[model samples]
Target: MESNQEVQISTNAIISFTDSYTQNKQRKEKELLEFESKSARAIISFTDSYAQNKQRKQNEQQESESTLSLAQVTSRLESLSNQIQYNNGCKLVIQIPKLLQSLIALVTFRIGTHLKQEIDLQRIEVRRQSRWCLSSIQVYGDEQIQSELVRQGYGRVMSITLSKAGGIDEEQDEEIYNGLRSISRFLRGLHAGRNNDYQPSFQPLPLLARRSIEQLEEEGANEEIEAQMNNRYNGLIKVWANDAKDMILNCFIYRRRR
Candidate 1:
């Protein structure tokens, strides 16, 4: 997705200063409104056939596959629970990642698209580890990421208008080279704002720049480069999802006193 290089913009702090300061708290409430990814298909698919066959051998067990959602049940848990609770009542909580990703994908897709034409976002995703965690809405998407940087950049211009509704502007940045300029500028601007200043321990790297780094690591690259690359890679991944988790917890803390 091309960046919205020329979208008119502004840094109006009208997003409720109270809420902005309470970014953590707002983050929590926002979090509660969302749930985690269920399970992954790659994992689920592998377990499905294995699970059914295993169940057949344990004919003494009486668990029905229909009872659980694909995203909520795991092969091991299902087996153990069925075995332990044979002819008895039991509670099983099997979590999967695929379902969660699907949910995040759906929500993100909707949000990004709904807000798209305005800034021209193509897609959205749940944060990096939302599938692993139970509640997080850190949105992710290549196009949306680009869109965010682009929109945030163009939105700052006084000549441009921030009130523009969903309508694609003719101008868009071509690639990461053009896009990061806006993102870097936007982030720097965010640092200027007092509210978003509580910088986290981790820093993020754009997805566009990760593949080569990862590829090099797999090839057993040099220590200095690998360490740096891994640190940056993991940092970005954490910032996307784990940072949100911390933010949500802190939000809860601040909320109690308020």
Candidate 2:
């Protein structure tokens, strides 16, 4: 009876050990599956975020390229030239130089070739060592004549005076200013490349005018004439002798024929 009771106890102990081992193996397997599932989820979430960021960047780049293309198209369209009729009047466009600070430009639209009306350019300012308020209309003549005068160095630009009243509309003033500025720039370029060898066809002034100019030069009383002589026609005496000076002085003193 004692041997039989010991065998039964040993058998019971072996069964309990087997049951515990099986329970531990199943728990470890479940934990491993849970950990693998979490790792896969994390990897998938990271991939999705990366793809979204890349796609968003590409979209922005495309949008920017489209905007640039549209701007270029608009610019090209605006630059297209339109036909202008001389009968209606010459549409003159003058580009002002950057050196001139105020009265952005002088322009005349629909100006007849023979027009000699005085123009009023409002908000004309000359910026030098000090700011000077200039006359609304600094110059007179049609677009063709004014353009020629400026081209030939016969324009009385330095003698412009400020007006007491009456000014053009703001929009017209701005347009004129722009045109004048453009012309200024063009004239500057032309002056820079002026042919020293090309002599202008000049007729001698009358005896009376020549005598007056000579007296003015001798006395040095006219500051404007002195300034013009010193600055604009430098080396005049050396190049063309006293005759050239007399000729230019005559142009300033006498009325120019159209």
Candidate 3:
């Protein structure tokens, strides 16, 4: 009887150990599966987020590109012109050489010899707006700003433009007049500024203007054109010079009084 009881106790102990081992194995397997599932979910979430971000960037790029239409450019130009009417705006734009070059390029841009009538008209309008902006800069800007513009080939461009002949319509005439006046005004400010106004690298406006006049004459500008150059253009230049001088003198006196 004692032997049987001992055997029964041993059997019970072995069964309990087996049951505990099986439960531990099952728990480990369940934990491994949960870990693998979580890793897969994390990778999938990352991929989706990456795809969404890429799509958003592409949409933004398309939207930005679409806004660069001709109408948008013209509207922006007009807005810029209006802003430049203020002193701060004029100063801000003048500091950026690239922006200045872009503005000048717009003035000189030509699509082709044969553009559609509508396209040509749009081009003309854009050019006109650009010219207006430049003119405003020359008018509102100081001598240093004017000198910078001239240094960037504004004077040279105007010289070439004014010297063009054979198509003098009302609009062309107006353009020429404005171009000439713009040069004259800038030259006036530059002269009044003297050594105090210009950078060391800049050439004098008077020298450039004289050379331009000579070039126009050599290009076969008629006597009528010559007279317009001599009287109307040069005469305005003199008037502007005097105006600039008086302005300087007044500023000087005012500072002295202060």
Candidate 4:
């Protein structure tokens, strides 16, 4: 009986040792699995951060390049605009009738006086044929002077003809003749004083003989008739000259190549 008991006790002790070993193996495997999961999560997080940083750098580089390109384009446009504005290739043809030489001289004088610059008469080409005159001139001075002339109704650009090479096209002989015809017609109408016909009738002052007692007493009979005539004539001359100046300046001048 003692021998049988000893064998059973040894068998029980072996079974308990096997169970402890199994439990330890299972616990180690669980810990290993958790470690692997944490490593995988860390790797994924690192990769995502790297990708975001690279993308942000690329976007910044593209924005910088775009800004540089826009600046270059703007600078080029301003340079081109300045070049075009001051270009000297442009010319003008002004037509005036032979009968209005004095008017043309007056207009030229006024232009010089107002602009504070002498008229370059050598640059002007005068062609007198039959009954009319043609004055061809080159466009000079800065944009300010050109703009001022336009504002004052001195220059009317009838047409702009471009050259084959993108410069000003030379003026044609036919254009000069056409301009003369137009000017002649305008001058004819103006000289006839058709616009004066539309003016309101002038109200004459009451004669001294027909004046009221109070008026006669206030204004003496010895009032100088010559002085009154002179004043009236001067006023009329001023008004008429201004009207004529505007009419002449407002005429169309053809722009063409030199």
On lDDT, the candidate that comes out on top is 3
Task: Tell me the whole-model lDDT of each prediction, alpha carbons only.
Answer: 0.25, 0.30, 0.51, 0.28
Instruction: State the lDDT of candidate 1 residue by residue for 1-258, as single tens digits.
Output: 011111101001111211232343344345434322222334556466556544553331122212332222222223322322232111111122232223222222222234324223322111111121111111112223323323322212211111111223222211211222222333332222213322222223333223322322343322322232333333442232333223222323432343
Candidates sorted by TM-score, best first: 3, 2, 4, 1
TM-score of 2: 0.18
Q: How far does residue 39 in candidate 3 sit from its true spot (Å)?
A: 64
State TM-scores per candidate: 0.16, 0.18, 0.50, 0.17
Worst 10 residues of 3 by lDDT: 10-19
Tens digits of lDDT, candidate 4, 89-158: 1121111112122212222221111111122221111111101221211122223322232232222211
Which regions of candidate 1 are displaced past 4 Å? 1-233
lDDT of 3: 0.51
Error of 4 at 140 (Å): 99
lDDT score of residue 110 within candidate 3: 44
lDDT for residue 258 in candidate 2, whole number 0-100:
17
Error of 2 at 167 (Å): 31
Better of 3 and 4 by TM-score: 3
